[model samples]
Every structure is written in C-alpha cells, then in structure tokens.
Target: MSQRERGTRRVVRSVAAATATLAAAGGTLLACAFAAPGAGDGRPVAGPGPCVPGRCPAAYPDPHGGAVVGRDNGVNVFVGGDFAVRGAAAGAEGRVVVEGEFDLAKGSGSPPAYHVGAVGVGSRVPPDNGSPFLRVGGDLKLAAGQRLLAEDGPVNGTVAFAGRQTGTGTVSPKAVRDTGALAAFDGLREELTAASTCYAYDKGVPRKPTGTAVNQGKVTVFTGDGTSAFQVFNAPFDLVAPDGSAQSLSFRKIPANATVLVNVTDENGEARTINTSAVALAGVRRERLLWNIPDAKVVRIAGGGQLQGSVLVGRRSSTTRLSVAAVNGRVFTAGSLAHESGTGGAGGQTIHAYPFVGVLPECGTGPTPDGGHTDTGEPVPFPTGVLPPGFPGLEGLEGLEGLMGRPGAAGPDDAAPAEGRELPREGPPMRASMAVGATLMAVGAALALAVLFRTRSGPGSGPGRRT
Candidate 1:
C-alpha cells in the first residue's frame, strides 16, 4: 500500500483508540450516576386523602412523601419519627413508613437485623401484591441479612430507603437510596393531639351524662350512658392497677358500635407516665375504642399484653421497652418516638394496624380546673369538619420526614437507636474501590494512543513523524 494510504489507516486507528478510552470512562461514570440515588419506589406521585372504595378513611391520615405513597390498607406503624432494630429479625404486620432514619442493626458488629417480606403485614384479606412493605424516608443502614421475603421464598423489589445506605448487608433487588415515599406529619400531629383533647374535652354534648370510670383495683369498669355515637369516659387515674399485673379495662352498656374515648389523665393535669396493659374489651371493639393519653409524655405497654384500641398520644411519645406489647389500633403519637422492636417473645407482639372508625363530639377545648372550659384553641373535630394542613388532604406535601415538634420527632439524629455507630453517607469501602475501573480504562487508552502514534507517524511515510 502507498505511504499516504498507510497514514490514513493510522489516523483511523488512533481515533478509534481515543474514542474507546473515553467511552470506557464515560461508562464508569454512568454506572455510578445510576447507582447514586433517586426516589426508590417506582410508584406514581399521589395527592393527600386518597380514598379506597370499601374502607373508611382513617381519622388520622397517615403521610405520604409529597404524594400518595400508600393506601390506608392497614399501615401498621407510621413513625413520623425513627427507630432501630436488633436481636432476632423484627417484622411489621402491615406497611411501616418511617419518616426518619432506619437502621437494620444498631451498628457494626452490634447485632444482625434482617427484614423478610414483600407484601404488607397484619391484614385480614390479601395484601396488594406490589407495594413496598417497609419504606424509610431518611438513610437506610443495611445489615448482613435484610431479605425482602415473598410467598415462594426470599425475594426482592419492595423495600425503598430515601437517604444513604451503609454496610454490605444482603438486600435483594439491591438496595437503593430513596423510594420517594416521604411525609410531613406535623399538621397531622397537631390534628391528632387536638382530636385527643376534644375527645377528653369536659364541656361534652349538652345534657349528655358523663360516663363513670370506677377503678376496681386490677380492672377498671367504665359504665356508660345509653348514647351510642360518642361515649366519653374519664379515668381520674392511670389505666394500670397499683401492682401492674392483669390491669384490664371493662366497658358496660356502651351500646353496640359506639365510638368510645377513655381519657386517662393525671389528676393535676401534669406530665406523667401511664403504663397501659393489653386491655380486654367487652362491649366495644378495638376499631371503635380510643385511649387518649392526653397528658402522659411516656407510654409503656405491659410486656406480654396487647392494648386493644388506638392510642392518641397528646404529648410527645415513645414506646419504652416496647417488647411484646402489641397495639391493636393505630399509634398516633403527638411527637417523636424511640422504638424498641425485635425482642417480642414466642407469641411475638407488634403494633397491629387497625384504623380508628370513631365519631367523636366537640367540647369547649379542655376541662378547666373547676370542670368548666379552658379555651385553648378551636375544637378539633373527630370526623374532622375540615381536614388540617397535613391531615390527608389534596395538597402535595414534599419530603418523607415529619421533622421536630411533630408527634414522634425526637430529632434528626434519632434515626437509629443511641447505642449503634452511625454509618457514613456512602456505605462500605466498595465505592472508593470503584476508582480502580477508571484506572484500567486510562491505561488501555494510553496503549491505544501509543499504537496509533507508532503506526501513523513512526517509520511510515507520514511527514509529521518525529525523531
């Protein structure tokens, strides 16, 4: 071949080599970019207060991350706060959404935590086959055995974390940064607290007789008037017996399908601790009963009992030593939460997801020192007249976290339990190791350039050949 033709061939080779090198680098960066982060779940964005046909909308509209995240298809736990897992694998009976940090285990070498499921838990009928069961709005700290379980076996594709993920914990379908499922539960927090206060409000319906709460040691008997819509009862003391065992609650003549609200408060209306056992209900059902802890800041459930009603915490709440104590209804805390899970006994207790279907009456805000009215603010309705800003409305709320001052918000750092070490933004040293691929690409490009240089301008008929 002529020298000129050889030079043209050399130029073509060099151009190809350079293009290949750049493509390799670009590919590496593309892979990292895709792996970086986005809203995890591929679900469509949703507006607030979306309704399903047969189910009644919960009085407490659980939050979605700027959109309708999940239906009220029995979301067992909505932590407008955060929690951590330890010991044996802790699981939720229904969908669980945490608007804060969720750690698989406490920390490195602490205790291994695993999640095994694809569908939502704790429902009577079959769960919707595709929605994620567990969603974390903040960072996700993965452990060794975080299996996304299915009916056939352990599978993947249902868990989504919005923030950083750490450790080499085995998460099927490979864990990502976010699922776009977030919440702003602040307004919902205020609404729930206000609703609790309304239920306990002293200036009840006109001429309606007050239900009597007679404490009889281990069991408290609440005798109601014949009214069936809203049965208001006042417990001058805590729900537990002095000894704390077999502390049961019994209702009399509450009329069938009556929405029952039992306000167990401190005599002086001060901050205190109320330990409620897994209560037994005689006349009322779990979905219709509400135990409004309007004053207590800390709530502890008995070790082996299940409390059979929704707990409307009017104060900032936390489930202290929450092992084996199952709540049969929704847990709408007024503030942040520090949860304890994975330690339930053989029977295994968890927050059972039963929506509150109660119709409550409005009173004059609260009870004054003399049984009159303390005009705090407007009366928050039970089946609220107008939905509050965050209480499941049409407005599109952004983000997954319902930060400080919301019902269960302790703080941002309260993502994991206090004991564990905080994982970094990017997990394990594997990311740093990705640079090795770039290095290899650079070397290949250099070799290609050398061959092109030699062929085009060295010992060939090219005029640009250098000595």
Candidate 2:
C-alpha cells in the first residue's frame, strides 16, 4: 500500500469512530429528555411525598391530570362522626382519632380488652413524641371495658378525649381529656370524599387492570403487571369464600414494587358489603395497598377477613360496621362507626398500623366527573387557602421552585420521595444530563467533520489536488 492509500484508510477509521461516539451519546440524550423526571438518574419518578398522604401533582387544575386521591395521613382509624362499640371491638394497632363520641360497649359476647398501640412494634418505627394514639372529640364510654391505647409491654403512647368519660377500663398514662388534637382533621372528611370520587372515576387510559383477577368458585386471584407503577383491581362481586377454611383472596403476578388499589364497587358505582376471613393478603404489603369505596353510604365488614389496605369512604354520614374483623392498614370514614373487633392483640384480630403509601391521582378540590363510572369530568380549581396535607398553598409555592439550576431540588417535573422518605440531597437534573449528552455528540460530530475535511483537502481529493 502506498503512503497516500494508508493515509486514506486512517481517515476512514477516524470518521467511523467519531460517528459511533455520536450515536452512543444520542441514545443517552433521548433518555434524559423524554423519560419521566429523575428516571434517568435512578430517583423515584412518582410516589407519596414527604408529608403524609403526599403532595398533589404540581399541575393541579389539569382536567387530563387523572385522579387525585388523598392519603391516609398516618392515622390508623379516622372517623368523622361517632365511634361506638356494638360488639367485642379490638382496638386499632395504630393511631385512632374519632371526631365524635367513642363508646366501647359491646353488643354481645364476653368483653375483650381492646388495645390501641399507635404505630405498633411490628415492622414500623414507633413515634417518640407523646402524641395520642387515641383521640375522641365527643363523649367517651368504655362501658364493657373498651380501652384506650394503654402502654402495653414495649408500646408507649398517649390518648386525648374532648368529652366526658364513662365506664371503666385501663387508660393510658398520658391521657388528656380536653385538647385540640382533632383540629387538623376539621375538613379532612370533605377533602377525602372528593378524592374518593376522583379515584373511583379516574379516566386515564389503559383500561382494565394490567393484572389478572380471576374469580374462582371460592377464591379470587390478583396478578399484577410488572411494567406499570400501579396495580389497580376491581375486586370480585363476592368477597367471601363460602367455605370457611379457604383463602378468599389470593395475590399473584406481583408487580415490581407496585402500589395496589382495590376498588370494590357494584356496576352502578356503589359500595359492597365486604365480608372477609381473618387471613392476611399474603403477597401484598400493608403500606402499598388501598381499598377505595367512592359512594359508600354504609360500609359493613362482617364475618372475618383481614383487610390489608387503607380504606377510604366517600360519604361522611355513612354508618359502618367494622366488627370482628382485622385491618392491616388505615381506615377512613365520615360517619358513625359500629365496631367490635373479636379479639385484641398482635396475633388476634386487630387494625394494624401500616399507613397507606400508594400513589393515587392528585388534583385540587374537584367534583365527580360527569359520565359513567369511568367518566372524568373537568377537575375543579386548585384549593384556595389553607390547603390540606398534600395540597400546597400560595406561600408553599416557594417549595415548588427547586434550587434554580442546582440538581436534587424539587423541580416541576421532579417527584416527591416515597413514603415520607427524604429527597436526594445532591444529583444532576434531567436537563443537566441532557445537556451533557448533547455536548458530547456535538463535539464528536465536529471532530469527525474537521478530520475528514483536512484529510480530503490535503493532497489528492479536492476541487484541485494540492500536492
């Protein structure tokens, strides 16, 4: 090979290498530009925020923003009205705040000692603050030995009641009869009602859950789709297994760390009487599940199945029978609660202290959509003043603007941390990553063109051969 031929080969190789570099950088740039904010750098895309129940999507009034349901706010059992004991009610494992009267009288059977240990010792970090695990706004009655969250064994918490106390029971050491613990929950009922409606009728595409929910003769199986972040299911018409010793609900096809929302409604968007056995949802975790009852005028959980998610009821005045059952997550209702939890203890039937950490649609105060059950009407305006836990107020908007050009600041496209986890302290934003990629590609292209032009114009390949 002559000198000129060898030089031509070298130029070809240099151009080929530069072109390869540009292609590699282009692929990375696309990911930075299009992927959900922070996805390129391995941060959580969207989930619950730092505050309980989490912040709403920054773009509030967007009609196309899908559903916007509030969270459980870390309270185990939240009732807007009276909480009366009609049976042997085992107190909740987590925090309990009743807006009205609290009665621990039993309708039948021997009185079982009720226990209320907020954020119980099992698998949860108990609170160090002496916050009340039980707060009653109205009259309190433990006629049949209904109890407060007494400091049992290693569990220590407080209780607060606003009204007169009746009956006899073991109360907590740090009990306050008159206080303002329930003030924060003043309008929470109305806010949750709107959210329940929105979640029930969220109109995002990809209809039909990506999982398989088959209703067998006695059991129902739920398999999740690993691709999506959420595993939504419309539970079977019949929730109870006719045979007592059968697993009524079975979970399968578990998604890769997904948030499951089970909407148990009738064909006309109504609530169903949930009768379950005293068995845990084996595959699903308590923190990641939600049971949404959008139009529940009355929620009755009879027989025995242990409900594994946070339940949200839309109607405030709805009467509820939460007797003789166990719930592993939070329970929110806006009506009178008729409760008798058969047994009370870590091993017995009880309401565990797992807060709901699932991601539902987050919008401003809005009305139910106008159409079928799935109809999504125009979302109402963003809240005006004194926003709820998740909704940011006018002054709070400052938190929205991340550190101008700094990485890790909460940007408009940036998602909140999961389950109150802290946001990353340092990192590059999506735009920064894209900029780096684009620069790399541009440099590679320029280098390639300059080398090719120099080689061709040098000796034998231009309009006029040089030497």
Q: Which of the numbered candidates is closest to the native, going by highest lDDT?
A: 2
Error of 2 at 190 (Å): 0.9
Tell me the whole-model lDDT of each prediction, alpha carbons only.
Answer: 0.44, 0.49
Candidate 1 local lDDT, 1-467, one digit each (tens): 75433443443443344335434444332322333111121111111111121232334332111322233433445554565564442344445566677666533433343433322334322123444556678876656654433221332336667887776565554455555656422233334444455455432321233588887887778888877577877775766677754466678878888878777664333343344444657668677787676545455544456677766655434333344455666565544444444333433344644555565553312111111111222111121112223333212211111111122212211122235533234433335323433443443344344434444443421111212
**lDDT, candidate 2, 1-467, per-residue tens:** 64444443443444345335434443333333333433312221111111132232222121111222221223556777898764455556545778898877654454546666532223233233355667788877776454555455555767788888777755766667876656544444544554554455443211256676666656667777756777887763546555433346777766655777776654333445666554345566656777766554557665555666667765554677775356656677755677765334222345655555566554332222111111121111111221233432323111101111111111121123335543333346445444444544444344334444444444322111123
Model 1 alpha-carbon drift over 4 Å, by segment: 1-74, 86-89, 106-122, 125-127, 143-157, 167-176, 183-186, 202-209, 267-278, 317-321, 338-347, 362-467
Models 1 onward score TM values of 0.54, 0.58
